[model samples]
Target: MTAPRASIGALSSAEFLPQRVSLLYRLSGNDVPAILLTSAIAAFALWGYISDKLLAAWLIWLVLASLVRFVLKRAYRLRQPGPEAAARWEGFFCLASAFVGTAWGVTVMLLYPEHGQFHEILLPFLIGSVAMGLPPALAPSPKSFACLIVPIFTPLIGLLFTQGGAFNTSAGILILVFSAVLLALYLSSNRALIETLRFGRENERLLEQVKEAKDRLDLALQAANILIWDWDARRTNVFLGGNWAIILRVGKETSALNLDELAQMVHPDDLPKVKQALDNCLNGGESEYVAEHRVKTLAGGWVWSLSRGRVVERDAGGRALRVTGVNVDIDDRKRAEVELLAAVQREKELSEMKSKFVSTASHEFRTPLATMLSSAELLEHYSESLSPAEKANLLQTIQGGAKRMSEMIDDVLTLGRAESGVLKLNLGPANLRELCSTVVSEFRIAQGKQHVITLDDRFDRPDVIMDERLLRHILNNLLSNAVKYSPPGSEVTFSVSRRNEQAAIEIQDRGIGIPLEDQPRMFESFHRASNVENRPGTGLGLAIVKKAVELHGGEISLTSAVGSGTRFTVMIPLRPVKQPAGVS
Candidate 1:
């Protein structure tokens, strides 16, 4: 064959052939029709010069060759699907086309037409018309199309030029132009067909890759037991992945679910909060929604789930149209986080209490130690020179300073026991009336006999089970504060009563009252009222009292106003449950 036209805008044969192979075999059906039609039309015209037997023989050969090409195409489709085998079939198809076209062209001279007009004009026009239509069947392989074209026209056009006349020469040149136009069209169509097939093949490869990736994603999700979900907000419908069945406590088969049905799986107590968070994200112009909530599991129990999502599609009015998110099983992580946070908070509290203890202890200890040092020095240096009463007064001052230091140490030890949760109690029968009386007497001495410390006990059998040492610490700190914080001559009343099998102790002081804001945290360790800075305190008294009461299995509540005196009521069960069950 003459050199095939340069393939413009076409894939390399290696890439194109594999995709174009089956299509080339399919073209065999179209080629047979065109060959038979052309042979039949040419036979009628050729009868003018050729004998009927010869003409019929040529037509029969074309028909049989066309039939054989069909059989080869079928076998190629079945056994020769690979590109190398398909390449051989393409060569055979092109050769068959060229052989038939050459046979038809040579007959113009071999038969030597006697009807001159039929040979010159009608015959050439018929051949050119049939050649132009060959591209549809053979265009994918441009070489095969060109093989059919040149064989039909080259000899006929050459014959026209050989005839010595202007009509003959011009007709020959016109035929050449027609052939050029036909070749250009064949090249264009061939280029388009190859490019189209390549594009389709590439598209199929991409689709397969996407399918494989989707399968991998599903496998990963299933392995992790993660549920992937998409919520169409406008439709209120949810599309869940296959793994959703693992978490959904339902039958084997499930139907479509709406947003409300999904929300129903959330714990009832947490559902309102979950809905609020979702509403805030969807309606409050926030694109993201995240929450850790308990979702009912397949066992009808709750598991903590962390759901995270964002509005991926929205309407122009800023409404959520679609939400995409994942529900990751976060039960273990959530429990761990809660425990860690509690531990961290406890550590923080201990740090603050220790810091306040260091600062307050240093200040409180320094004052009493300094006072005792001064009193001891005065007695040692001036005892002989001073009057008997002067020596006696200094001795009392030393005793008082030492007593205050002892009380501060006791409070500190009590606090340490409470913090370490190893507080030991000695339970016994104790008289509430005598307990109040004794605590008041200590208060009377500490306030220099000026403040009126009175006891009002309204109990018949005032005996109760309690640890007397903790009870004493509780009473001592309250009475000391009552005397220390109040002005001289203010009455501090201690009241004890029994009712409903619970003993209640009330300490009423006319001291500078606690502020409302400070009341909440007043019992917290290292917490002293903003108004109590002028007083000498370790900031541990109230904290120790609350711990002591809690150990006694009771609760404490306080009511106070700034500048008005504070009243503290402590209640204890008549029968305290020491080492209560589930306490640890």
Candidate 2:
């Protein structure tokens, strides 16, 4: 019977009591380590109630609760878990609360039946109910009211049984009124708690959503390669995202900058100009700000950025407090512009070269053609008086010169057709064997008895779809090259075969082959191999060959080496075209 130390707060007796209530609540539904405390409370309440020292029983229960709380605080530190794990623990907390609630109700009924302070039970029951109801408030689970409602109803039933006709009618009426008041308080308290928790939970959810949306927006800006910046028009304070620092290769340390520090970072040549532009934007003259400047980088290099901004918000005084914008690295675009300008200039020069080429070619062609025509006309008039040898020489000279002029005209025409994309191919079936034979025959007549031109025994295709005129040109070019480049006694041979539904024609010659270094550009317009300096060509032959082959959906390849022979293989599809209606 030592008086308890002064209670901690307004309800000192109750103050000590709440801890025991809380412990019993915590241990009831949970796997709390073997708590002998709740069991002790039950035994002591029952013993003290029978002994009739109501104060002693309540005090004993309170002391045990306080001791258990102290130990729980010491043993289980209330450190926050990682986000996901904490959510699971919240549910456990609720379930544990429900079990603790039922146990506390049972213990209160068994212990201290004479205290009749039904209100004393409200603390543990409310806590357990709330625990069961409001778990994972910030987490993703449903709140359940069953724990609160069940514990609430259980206490009422216990109250009814406790006051069951044991007292006089007046005393009984007083007990019933007290119980009703406790029930009302409990209901009101729970409603208040639930409303507060709901508001807090909704606020947290909104904050989380806002944070996620901001994160997604930041990611999108980075993906678009944009840099963000903000400025206070009145104070002229600048805020820039980390990407802005990255673009300039600058370390983004925080600094209290006035105007001078900012101006120092800009290139000396651009500083004044940029300041003026910023001033103009701040004056509300324009909603947007655009400027180009160079900034010194931490890496000791200068980078160019195209900065664009706009006034985001302004004070009532019309002073802009916030401006937001982006800065873009435009160095590549600037360099490309310079290169494009240079390319345009080069094109102008190439156009001049074309003019010269046309003028010179026309003059050269007119001289030979005019001589051939004059010679022919004079011969027609004076042929009877002329000696046979003189007439024959004149006729031969006229023919040779006319052929040269014709070849030059054809070259000019070919170049024009190729450049303008006007080259046409009339595709039809041609006999591969016959085409090869015809090419070899022409070469033989052109070469006379100097060199041998032969078709290999391998020539075998029955027919192939191709433009007959283009194929004739391809064959003529290959054979003529072989005849012109081969040594006096060297043999030029043509071969044909089929593989995988396509036809291939090969021309092999014992001629000076192309050099390795010049092969890449060999099919480029106006390009000629170094080894072919002694040959006469317009440098359009192989380029035309490549273009024509591609147009036919086929390809050509050349295998050659210096001082060795060359092999030109032209592979064409079996069907180069499909005829439209009425075509035969």
Candidate 3:
């Protein structure tokens, strides 16, 4: 029943006039044969009562009028005039019908017999029969029906009343009543026809609007990368629409999928979560289903999507019969969330490392400070009573404490520079064999009496472009660790060789090796092996050595066991030698 306001008004207005005209023309054709036959019968009955010429003339006029109406109907069919010419066609029809009605009126006045009782009754009855039939044929146009009916009935009724007799008066009254009823019937049928056409137009307009609205909705959903879905619980089938194939990375032919097929496309890890959400909603545990999961694409990859739905239709027993939902592409948002979490985790690790560094630095610095303080106190308070040898021993103790503190401070500064990415390599010519031998000889003079240290220089090209300071740091730390961790009389070996255009240095020691679990983080700042309990070291030696090696474009690796010995390998790429000004 709902229609546009413009269309509703036009239904009753001149907009429908063309359709009414067309209906009138078509219906009038059926009445043509009936009209001609009725006229012939009336003329035959009046033959003996009236003059042959008068009866023949009236019959000829009626036949001519009927023929004119037939011609008009034929013309209308041939032309099929549009709405613009509806008024002109309607005028022609009404005029032709009026001419026919006037011919019938002349029959009553000219052909009614004065002496013949049966003829008088016959003439009026024939005219009245024709009037009654007009309503249905011309219902679509009440004006045309009026034009035909009034001319025929007015004269017949008046003549009956003017003639003097009870029969004439009664006949006139009956004819008048019948005329009134026929007019009323015409009006009623006309109103019914208009109502039917109005409803038809409204239905058509409503259909057009519904189509437009559905098209707009489809466009909006496609632009937003959203797909609508409808599920029929009874059938166990899903209907997908609105860019579904594009968003899901599937073929357009794939518009319907069963629950099992849908589950197969979901990521294995996220299947349970998606299923649980749907079950909760279907079972009335929740009013809606919402879940984020990864869907497999045709290209053998996964993309994140957010699904939302609600049970839109239910049975009498409160069980879901149908559900409607949407799937949204959320791959970008999910990726961003993962990256944010990684950044947060990295920040947390850095904070923990900072805390550990402060605690270890405090503990390491306190020991040396205490040693220096006690040694200075002893030398100051017992200067008069102490012998020369005893005084010398206290001074040595003070110097050793200060030296240890200075070494620890230097290691802390060097590690800080390396971690901050401010450490740079100063490349120049240096001999790898000499550097190794020099470090070994220094360690022998220092602790060679306790532990045996040896250097095997196998590298043919020992003179290479390198950072001397960084190389010395690498040699000094490895030798120190080897000597310190090993028992007295244990042997340590340092070997230098060339491998694949790089210098390879290997240091081996028969020491109480690092624990397997702690070896992975051996180069981490302030991270000491768990087995090095009560060892007199700050745990920064290997950390500094790692940074120095990295600055020279090198890699360091180690192999160790808890009870067996450990070996460290450092590989540095040899820099190409620079030639003098003219050399290429």
lDDT of each: 0.76, 0.64, 0.83
User: Which residue segments of model 1 deviate by more than 4 Å?
Assistant: 1-225, 230-236, 242-255, 259-325, 379-384, 445-449, 576-584
- State the displacement of the C-alpha of residue 548, model 3, in Å, after optimal TM-score superposition: 2.8
Q: In angstroms, give how far residue 29 of model 1 lies from its true place.
A: 48
Tens-digit lDDT string for candidate 2 (52-137): 44334444434443354345434334543444444344445445435544544555455534445443443343233223323222
- Whole-model lDDT, candidate 1? 0.76
Q: How far is candidate 1 from the true structure (C-alpha RMSD, Å)?
A: 13.9
- What's the lDDT of the predicted structure labeled candidate 2? 0.64
- Over 4 Å off in model 2, which ranges? 1-209, 212-216, 219-223, 226-400, 411-425, 487-489, 498-502, 575-584
Q: What residue pairs clash in candidate 2, if any at all?
A: 20-65, 29-100
Candidate 3 runs further than 4 Å off: 1-227, 234-236, 242-254, 581-584
> lDDT tens digits, residues 187-299, model 1?
77777887787788889999999989988987887677577778886565788765566654444535357877777888989888788888888885566798878877666
Worst 10 residues of 1 by lDDT: 1-10
The residue pairs that clash in candidate 3, if any, are none
Task: Please give the distance, in angstroms, between residue 69's alpha carbon in candidate 1 and its true position after superposition.
Answer: 54
lDDT of 3 by residue, 201-274 (tens): 89888988998988898788877878888999888789987876687676555778998989998999999999
